[model samples]
Target: MEQHTVVLYGKPGCGPCVAVKAALERAGIEYVYVDVTTSPEGLEHVRELGYQHTPVIETSDDHWTDFRPDKLAALAKGLGS
Candidate 1:
């Protein structure tokens, strides 16, 4: 099965972001994380997505505001559990 690409935009010390990543890792899913807080392109990147918040998890096809267990699951195998 082909895995979807996950681009997680988070700040330096976001608990929710950490939780999301942890869950994904526990599931053995692959993902790329981006810290928008310290990046100069943060505003531009988020603006393009029409979202103005940290911890915006982006899959290849969609964006999840929470990226919690359920949200990550949706992007997991078969859109998650």
Candidate 2:
């Protein structure tokens, strides 16, 4: 498994983040969406990965800043290996 779980760290008014979410939805991916603007835990989680913005896509083994496609794939697939 490339990821144990998919966590999408997002904030309000982020267009790219929104696109990322939409892509995930369109791909039929299951993920946990967290609004960092409202959740300190969410911010702290991604902070460990050095991301200081919204929409930090994360898995057990990967962190996607700015919504990368590979990250999305890993998120959709998960840590099954």
State each model's CA lDDT, in order. Answer: 0.73, 0.78
* Residue 10 alpha-carbon offset, candidate 1, angstroms: 0.5
Worst 10 residues of 1 by lDDT: 72-81
Query: What is the lDDT for 53 in model 2?
Result: 80
How many clashes show up per model? 2, 6
The total number of steric clashes, by the backbone 3 Å criterion, in model 2 comes to 6
Candidate 2 deviates by what RMSD?
3.3
- Which of the numbered candidates is closest to the native, going by highest TM-score? 2
Estimated TM-score per prediction?
Answer: 0.78, 0.79
- Pairs in steric clash, model 2: 1-79, 1-80, 1-81, 2-79, 3-79, 9-55
**Model 1 C-alpha lDDT per residue in residues 18-59, reported as the tens digit of each score:** 888888788777777787866767547876888877778777
Judging by lDDT against the true structure, name the best candidate. Answer: 2
What is the C-alpha lDDT profile of model 2 across 26-75, one tens digit per residue? Answer: 77877789998898888888798798887787766767789687766665
Q: List the residue pairs that clash in candidate 1.
A: 73-80, 74-79
Q: What lDDT does candidate 1 reach at residue 49?
A: 83
